[model samples]
Target chain A: MKLSILKNELNEAIQNVSRAISSRTTIPILTGIKVDVTFQGVTLTASDTDISIQSFIPIEDDRQTIVQVERPGSVVLPAKFFVEIIKKLPSQHIEIEMQDQFQTLLRAGSAEIQMVGLDPEEYPVLPSIEEEQVFSVNGDLLKTMIKQTVFAISTNETTPILTGVLWNLQDGELKFVATDRHRLASRAAHIEVDTELRFHNIVISGKTMNELSKIIPDQNTMVDIVVADNQVLFKIDHVLFYSRILDGTYPDTSRIIPNQYKTELVLDTKKLTEAIDRAYLLSREEKTNIVRLQTKEDGTIEISSSSTELGRVTEQLEVKQFNGEALRIAFNSKYMLDVLKVIECEHIFLGFTGAMSPIIFKSTENVNSLHLILPYRTTT
Target chain B: MKLSILKNELNEAIQNVSRAISSRTTIPILTGIKVDVTFQGVTLTASDTDISIQSFIPIEDDRQTIVQVERPGSVVLPAKFFVEIIKKLPSQHIEIEMQDQFQTLLRAGSAEIQMVGLDPEEYPVLPSIEEEQVFSVNGDLLKTMIKQTVFAISTNETTPILTGVLWNLQDGELKFVATDRHRLASRAAHIEVDTELRFHNIVISGKTMNELSKIIPDQNTMVDIVVADNQVLFKIDHVLFYSRILDGTYPDTSRIIPNQYKTELVLDTKKLTEAIDRAYLLSREEKTNIVRLQTKEDGTIEISSSSTELGRVTEQLEVKQFNGEALRIAFNSKYMLDVLKVIECEHIFLGFTGAMSPIIFKSTENVNSLHLILPYRTTT
Candidate 1:
């Protein structure tokens, strides 16, 4: 490859592709990043077998020249050194040329670096999927959906399928669900899609979703996702991300959600979050993480936690609205805090069927999202 | 204790003293912070048997009420819980009261917390040093001096004295020196003090100096230093720090620094730093960290490093002035980079005696500071 590229533009493209390069890969060539230069643009690709990422830089962006090509060629350079050297280059313009036997020369201002590059043919090819089943979603909404549901996925390796989030599409509604049996988070959005084009039981690992979220633009852009029989591809502007789908079927969770609530209370989200956080500090010391909540006749709730070594924490929070019977329930304070953190609304509505049933949490303003946590049955 | 204190003021004091509390201490009571409240003010103290830090908050400062005291008492609470709770408290005004049996009650807004407190009598008392030998320096100058020399201290525990920075005070000139046998850094400043006061062989651990540097204000405020026989105390605005001096005689480092130079070159500090940093990336991979420098007959210098597996990095840099004979020298690039990072001047002057002797680095604008790095003897 013989080309002169803008330092800032090339550096950003390298960083995006480097997210898929894993240091512990068993294959030697997998540790290097593949670079291909043509008349149209320059492309950088990296893979760790499980996931692959590719970023392309066009010749011009908004009338500003980003690259000037002298020749078209391909080579693979060590990601560890290439990434660091590109970031610390001293000048705004960099020239890269390939020499005899795949020797690569890079010049940035007065500094010149030479490295032995691997043959591009030695690198593994990324899986290509037919783009028949594809759907587009707004980038901001996609990131929010991933953030709201990905944290509840199971981390255990015994049940491999539980480590991924389940994706279901019906009519024009797309829904995501993740659960580790103790707690579950579900988020849904209405996307423009054909009514006949629907898919279910498609699961993607939580880790892959996190990496995709990072590359997605924060503004209101469109992201296209193509689903294949075994692999899925996500296209975000100039970047392409591919991941393998889990093999086993996801567990059915629709029956576990209670259809009715015996008691429902609406309270300010910030007040409840702070009260549980303080109680969590003490309950965490006891390793039980259990906090008690009791409703009184005066339309107030008491939140408290105690440890044998440390003393106790108690707070009385007023509820905006209360209905049904008064009840006392104990639940994990850490789990409750996690659910409350993702709630962006000012008020939250909590529904309880009984002491042993799952407690439902929903943002007062948004009806498309809900969280469920199982209550702890304490003898006290 | 019964008082209402401003949350921000108390939180700052707690954070300052919490730096002295060590989690690995053998003594159980040392893990807790001792709090003493009196009509005059409130003092927070924490110690790890090696160093003690105390911060005092007066009843009122500059006509603003910081603490309103109704009773006088003292208690010891676990530093881990107390520090975190105070930061996350929901209100600006916090009321603390001492209940029966050493139990403490803290109320902020609607949340109430009760913590089991240890007996204040069980806590070890801080060492009382006589303030006979005293001097003062600007806090900003002291912080700068510490940063310039502390990184060269030997981390190995076999030679206990080398782990501390040597302090020499004579004729109102205060000097600090640190060396690990391979590299040395020295910084000196003139303070207004008794000309007859001379002290030597005083060494304080690098770790303690780092912690003290963090607490020192970045602004130009006078800080008093009292040097006792075996302990040193630093008094900042409202904080007092006590540290035990290291035992042993420091080695003499004067003989290693050459008084004469055969070659001297001046170059821009930023350009040299960037050149050495790029070469360091390759040399670090070879595990030798060796970079070669040679003065050219054409009035320029070449800096390069090569690895057996990876290739090489070479850069030709221009010097502002070149004096004496042409020379080639090799040294650890990591050490050279470390010295260059601390230089605040725009231009740096390098003095070399020979290819194998010590190379000196000094800021062209400052006369009170200098750094020395022993060159590596390589056959090439």
Candidate 2:
């Protein structure tokens, strides 16, 4: 294989795929990035047995030549060293040529690096699925859905099914739900999709979903999602993201969501988040990391926390509206902070059935996102 | 103690002294900062047995009132929590007051924090030294001396004396020397001092010197340094720093520095440093981290390094002049990099005694700083 490419273009493409290169050397071949050169352009692939990433640089971009291919071939070079040398090369253009015995030469300016490359046949092939059962959605909406629910998924391996986010689609609406038994987060959005496109059971591991969220751009551009029997693919622009679906069925979480509440309060989201954050800082030294909230009849909410060894902190916040009766409850401050971070609204409505029941938090402006947290029992 | 101080001023003073607060809880009082309020001003002090820092906020600055003191007393509060609370308090001026007992109230806006305070008498007292043996020098020059030689101090605890920098004064010249037996760095400067202020020996611990270096400003303003039998004190414009001296005899490193050499080379410092840095990055994968340099008869230098596992890198640099015979030598790239960083000159002169002896690095512009590194024996 012999090629000369612009240094900036190759650096960008290599960086995109380098994120998937395995730092662990358990699988020796997994540490190499597969490079393929053709008449059209050059493609770089890297995978760590879980998620695979590939980036392609076409020969022409905006009427400018990027790559000149002398011959078409494939080879796998060490990803870490190759990327470092390319980044530090002191030239605008780089020349890369591979010999018959897998000896690769990289030259730029006055520096030359000769490294042994591995045969491309030793690299693992990425699984390919036919484009079937596909749906189109806005990239920004999909990114928001992933961000809102992915953090709530259980990380414990014992309950493997709970580690995947549940995806349900029906009537041009897409919904995502994730839970760790103690707290839950759910989000829904409307997308343009054919009425016949429906999925009864499809769940992607939360780990893979989170990784996809980072690479996908948060814009209004449309992306196509294709589902196979055991795999799912997201195609946006020139990038393709593939993930394996969980084999077990997700648990039914609809019944656990509270339908009614006796006490309700409406407050500004930013003010309440800051107050809870301050209370959290004071409660970090305590055993349960709990903070108490009490609503008075005069439309005032008091946030307080105390530790036996670290003193106490109390803050007062004004509530917009309160209904039903005065209530006092205690819950983990970290869980509440996490839920507040995902609720994208100026004002939020919180519903409580009783002291021990799970509380629901939803935006007063948008009803698409919902968060629930279980209260901790306090002796006082 | 009862007073109201501007939040910004209080925050800055706390941050400066908090760097010396002990994170270990064995001596609980050492983890807190002592706040002393008097009719004159407020002083914050923190110490960790080895180093002590004190920052004073006067009642006025630039004809503006800052702190208003109502009662004269002192108390110690937890350093971590006090700093955090002051940083996050939502007000321009914070009110801090102590009651009959050891309970302190800190209030700003609608937020109030009540923390338990310890009696200031229980805190460790900082050593007091007279200003009879004091000399004034430019802050910038002192900071430069610490930065150049401190990095060469030995980090191992086997020999306690090598872990400190040796300071010697003679004939109105102050010199600093530090060595770990492998490499050595020395810097000298002329300063104004009383003739009777001569010191035979003064060795400050590396850890304490580093702390002082960070807090001292690099400028042309003068700073007062007071020397005691076992402690040294530095009084800047508004900050006072005290450190305990290391108790050991420093080795004489004057005999180790070579005065003459068999070969000498003069080259641009920036170009040579860059070439050596690139070679070091490529040679890091090898066990010895060794980079080789050969001086050709035509006054050109070739720098190269190779790893059996990663490959090789080579670069050429043009030299201005070369004396005596041609030579080749290998040395630790890290040590060379450190010495190169401290050479403050556009062109540097390198003197080599032999293949196995130490190489001397000196500046052609400034003759006050010198660096020496021992060469590594290589098979090829």
Number of the predicted model whose lDDT against the real structure is largest: 1
Docking class of 2: medium
lDDT of 1 by residue, A1-380 (tens): 79999999999999999999998998989889999999999999999887899999999999799999999999999898999999999999999999988889999999999987899999999998999899999999999999999998999999999899999999989999999999999999999988787899999999889989998987888999999998989999899999989999999999999989999999999999999999999999899999999998889999999987778999999999999989999999999998999877899999999999999999999999989999998889
- Residue-level lDDT tens digits of model 2 in B1-380: 78999999899889889878877758889888999999889999999888899999999899778999998789998788888878888788888999756778888876778887888999988998977778887888888888889989999899988899988877788888999998999999888976555775588888877888778776766788998889889998778989888888899888989889898999889888877877787777675779998987667888888876566777778987788778899999989989888787899999999889898999898889888999999879
What's the distance in Å from true for residue B105, model 2? 1.3
lDDT of 1 by residue, B1-380 (tens): 89999999999999999999998998988889999999999999999977899999999999799999999999998788899888888999999998998899999999899998889999898998998999999999899899999999999999999999999999899999999999999999999999988799999999999999999987888889999999999999999999989999999999999998999999999999999999999999999999999998789999999987778899999999999999999999999999999978999999999999999999899888989999999988
Model 2, position A147: C-alpha lDDT score: 86
Model 2 scores a C-alpha lDDT of: 0.85
Model 2, span A57-166: residue lDDT tens: 89989978999999988999888888887887778888889986677887877677777688999998888898878898887888889989998999999998889898
Evaluated at residue A175, the lDDT of candidate 1 is 98
DockQ of 2: 0.58
Candidate DockQ scores, in order: 0.78, 0.58
Interface RMSD of 2: 1.6
Local distance difference test, each candidate:
0.93, 0.85
State fnat for each of the candidate structures: 0.83, 0.46
Best by TM-score: 1
